[model samples]
Target: MEDSDDFLRLILDSIAENIAVIDEGGGIRFVNHSWSQFGSDNACSITQDWSKMNYLSVCDSAALAGDEFGMLAGNGIKSVIDQKEAYFNLEYPCHSNNEQRWFIMRVSPFELNKERFFVISHQDVTERKLAEKAVEKLARRDGLTNIYNRRAFDEILSEQWQQCLTLKQPISLAVIDLDHFKLLNDTYGHQIGDDCLIAVSALLKNFARRTGDVCARYGGEEFAVIWSYTTLLEALVLSKALLEEIRQLKIPNERSPIAPYMTASIGLVEMTPNRILETRDLIAQADDLLYQAKESGRNKVSSLIVVPSSAVENQN
Candidate 1:
């Protein structure tokens, strides 16, 4: 019987997942080698001996300290222990200072000698999670410029619009078009035009360093930027700076008119979102302003603030 128990322990230790068993009262009953190793590697407080610890108490402490995953894991384990749930599973991030990591925790209940126990296992799922993120990024990124694509731009704009609406903050959008880009492509091969787009996209990325800022390839030689919590005046300042930076790139545009170097025209709009207005209205207004910039001689910013009808009526 002792040899048989030793063999079972060896098999459990050989498994890669961190496994542990707890009694009905959540008292740690046993833990496999992987569980001990993981605790030691992570410098966990429970590395010395888990038998003296209560698993549910650890989760409760984490919950009190504002760990949502802890609260969820505690509830899941309790449901399984109470026989209300046959099994429980959760996926969560547990990133370390050195690298990002993900793990899936699974809990299953069992009975031995008429005593109920719960077996919990945590499996690393970082590789699969990273692969999923890679695929999602490719779907949202432009192949040529390596910037967010038009679809991503639309999604980001709509999301930011909703957030700004909920916060009652201002959101800004910029519609930028390269001046005479078709002529530039026609004059100096498509390769040069592609290179120019790459350079401009790289520059635009610098301005979008903020949490809610997004720069995307709108389509062709056009690009869009979404600035959360920004007013029209603030957007105009940045738009003018962007224009100068693009001109500073000095990508030769010896095709026809407008400076000897490449230049761009921008249409900028800022608005405090309201139920009466849609995201499309913001785009439309910015597109119109962009047209105005082009018509008024390219390489400048035309900006406006869109006031909802209710706000205008309230002002009167």
Candidate 2:
């Protein structure tokens, strides 16, 4: 029995996991090389008691709960250990070199002579996680302006629409068109016009960073943003901010009639859950407002706020 036990221990310890044997009294009796390595470099030995380690609480909780506690030990880790089942592919973010790093953890429980034991393994998966995230971002991002792509916009819109339907929240949509973008291209060359587009995109992006905001390039010289759960007044504020931000760019629009430099026309439309508003209708209304801004004079913002009346009222 002793030979068999020693052989088994040798084999299990050889595997890449922090393996430790706990006696019936719940004290750590043995810790393999892998287990010792999990401790801080300043620590002298693994049998020095688990409570002395900085991460003891994290490890203990994960051992008790099947839930996914984070690397710092929360409900997640506890879920796995409490169930006495195997856990795999658990991911959590860590800070290394002042940057985010990801780790994949696996934990399993074992027993010997009625004593409880556990094996834990953690692998650095930062590179793989970053690659996967980058791919997802590229798939959902517009190449030109680095805004969310139309595909992402569609997904967000559909999700928000469903949410608004259920929660009866308000959703606002805006369509913005660059004023005389073709004229700018003709006067400054297409390359310079592209630069202007990039600059304008940056300004719009800054505003869209707010909660429940999403922005996308709807195609050439045109961009769109959807604000979920936003009031009409809030939507109007963003619209005004967007127009002013573009004007501040000072792209030297010597050819523009509305201003000495480049400018944009923005149209905003808000829909409430009480109203039956389709995404297409919301877009069309905002587009109509954009045209209104152009008609009145470019470089201005016009909002079409939906109300109890059948007719639309204009807000600047």
**Over 4 Å off in model 2, which ranges?**
1-123, 157-168, 254-260, 274-281, 295-297, 307-311
Write down the lDDT of every candidate, Cα atoms only.
0.91, 0.74
lDDT string for model 2 (1-316, tens) is 6579688777766866555543323344566656666564425464456644434454565556753444334343445446634653466775555677777666556776775554556666778999999999999988888998788887888788778868988898988899888888988898998898888888878878876788898889999988998977888888888888888888877877777788888888888745466777777888898888889987777886776566566746
RMSD (Å) of each candidate, 1 decimal: 3.5, 6.1
TM-score between model 2 and native: 0.65
Residue 10 local lDDT, model 1: 94
C-alpha positional error of residue 47 in candidate 2 after TM-score superposition, expressed in Å? 7.6
Give the alpha carbon lDDT tens digit for every residue of 57-135 in model 1: 9999999999999999999999998889899999999999999999999999889999999999999999999999999
Candidate 1 lands at a TM-score of: 0.90
